[model samples]
Target: MKVWKSVVSAALVSVLLAGCGSNAGTDNEQNEVKAGSTVNLKVFVAQPRLKEHYDKYIEQFKAKEKADKNIEVNVQLEMPPADNAPQILKTRLASNDAPDVFALHAVNEIPPFSKAGYLEDLSNQPFVDKLLDSVKPSVTDASGKVVAVPLETLSWGYLYNKDIFKEQGLEVPTTLTEMKAVVEKLKAAGITPFELSYKEAWVPQLFLPLTVGALTQTEHKDFVEKMNKDEASFSDMKALFDVFDLVNANGTDKALEVGADDGAAAYATGKAAMWIQGPWYAETILKSNPDVNFGVAPMPLNDNPDDTKINLSTSTSLAVSSSSKNKEVALDFVNYILDDKDSSAFYEALKFNPVAKVHTFKSFPWVDDALKYVNEGKAYQDPKIPQAVKDESGKALQGYYSGQLNQQQVIDALDKAWKSYNKVNK
Candidate 1:
């Protein structure tokens, strides 16, 4: 488990794991469920908000398995709290208590999990051919093995109130200058320019992927690789603060006290004209206010319009555990996740963008808004930044918001986190 331990440490330097076995099981084992036997399959996901959707899907899968294979599956579906999920999952993996099938952020988690031989190779699965070409690379490991099922094909930046923008006679900004003007206009019209949700570090941490993706794809080419090698510094990307500062300064009041759900409520109720969040929370926001007219747009990172681009990514994906005794049933369940007949409905129910060729449901307006950028070639793949660095940025941004740390301190913290990640990973 030394390699698994290193993966966890490199990705989360702050969260330590006890060492265990690096391998889950040998590939020589023929893992399958006996016909007519009841199998207990464990399925873990980081999204607790979509428990109902998953429950329904699992029931469907159970019925399908019973009818097709004469096998009964009692799925133990686990949806843990988001903040503690990564730590909990790492602990479970290190202790050799891995789930049969689990969900992870494809680009961030697949590499390490595959390197540790925790993920079963899924390249030859039926769902592989069903995946869209755009999302294939996301689920593929460094060695080119398809290791996961793409679940959330994402095109995101900032979620904005379309109706508010219309009422204020403001259009989505295309550059830093236009964005500043839009902020001022919203403020002058007695509207909060942004929704700041800092109680959960991950919410504020959204800036890292959005900011880093856009800049690295355009002006800051090779920055991610350089940072990974400890050859670059966040000090060089100080332009990020131009928007981060404006967002924090113009956001709603009592931001530090507000968590993501509360922030969604405020945004849905028009407390702010815009929120720097992804469409993944649209379901939550609609729950708060179903009529909220939201749209997604690329955040303007700099004066160059070319620097503003949507983030195209497969954010969440499903993978089978190689160590599972019931790999047959687990892989069957994973393949069924993208079943042509049911996948579109499931993705539609979850308000997620389609990732597979089988998904034909029309996406929400906000998703379409973001996809317009993707369709027009104004999008960049989400950069592969260490999870530890993203976590550090979230904590650092919270301090930046509280005036406990200045811009330089935040930059220094990120640089240090990247260096620590490189050390452990190397």
Candidate 2:
């Protein structure tokens, strides 16, 4: 499933490390280390929110490596802001200053990075066989080469406060019409209908996957392929404005000033009944207010009940840079992420969904809430939309919300972006 393909973008490569060129390692840096030698490994990831958990895991890996191999591994973790990470990483890779290890959205990033000869082929790694069947495809390239370690396998949708829903006697809506009714009832009962954080282009841009996934899977089956071929237009799916307009009209005020972190705090505190977000932020939400009773539900995209399916996919994944001087140590760390004995606790501590067979922890209630739809086959794999197109959609939607553009202008922008992307990619 392409669910997690482009969900989270790749992280930045620290400019401070630019002095350490891609070929910085000596001839002896190739993993056959002498006893008591020290190896420095630079690691980068997109989610700065999970730094604490990652730090703990790296410490454990360090201690274990010292004990088992008589070698010291110095791991430098780099986490830049998510909004600009992808562009920075692109520049880093182009300059041959790639990190030893980094996180990327598996499906969307792997192919391009692999074509650029920037990714190591992990198809033969020990952890490849241990991945869950459902998640294997996300990290596998067209040649069946598994290029990354899949981390987050998400069954996500909008988050709703169970307490508020129950208190207001509201059921999860399965269509846009029902969703509108739910909004009115929530407003009547003195609760904000939605939590909107449009300050970040990526936040408002999430509507693309939620709406396009449902549409392509059912109503507009050929949409992505046609768009890729320049035979289709965004005007075909203009109905997306329905949910966009509805939520924008009823959500908490001053949305353009609010970012995801603040929006999570607002959602956790019950300032709004629903938030159009994925479970990837559950860690941040629970940290802000542990007592918040929340559950995941499909975002209603249209009047058709079938279009309200949950989004099931993978998010961030770990990969070793093929150009790294310390390939051996980098691969070891990637394998360590899926270690049979330590992985369950690691994933659970991060509140990430299980992505490998070694994961044995019980999932949170919200995960199960989303799984209820997945079990019923009421979920769709994320469509393979071009990253440039997705980026354009997010920026265009942000403009639409701020009154700088209208629906037609947004549609025209997306169509133009798609054609430009096709020209370059071809």
Whole-model lDDT per candidate: 0.83, 0.83
Predicted candidate 2 versus true structure: per-residue lDDT over 119-201, tens digit per residue:
78899999998899989989988777898998888888799999999998999999989999999999999899999997877
Candidate 1 local lDDT, 1-426, one digit each (tens): 000112333543322221314345453287466679899999999898889999999999999999998999999999986666776776676666789998888877786667666788899999999988878988999999999998888888999998999998998999989999999998898888999888887887888888888888767898998887888899878877888898988988887799888898899999998999988888889999999999999999888998899988787898887778778889889999899899899889899888888889887788778778988999999889877777677778888878887898888888887888777566
Global local distance difference test of model 1: 0.83
Q: Which stretches of model 1 miss by more than 4 angstroms?
A: 1-22
TM-score of each: 0.93, 0.92
Residue 425 alpha-carbon offset, candidate 2, angstroms:
1.9
Superposition TM-score, candidate 1 onto the true structure: 0.93
Clashing pairs in 1: 1-21, 1-22
lDDT of prediction 2: 0.83
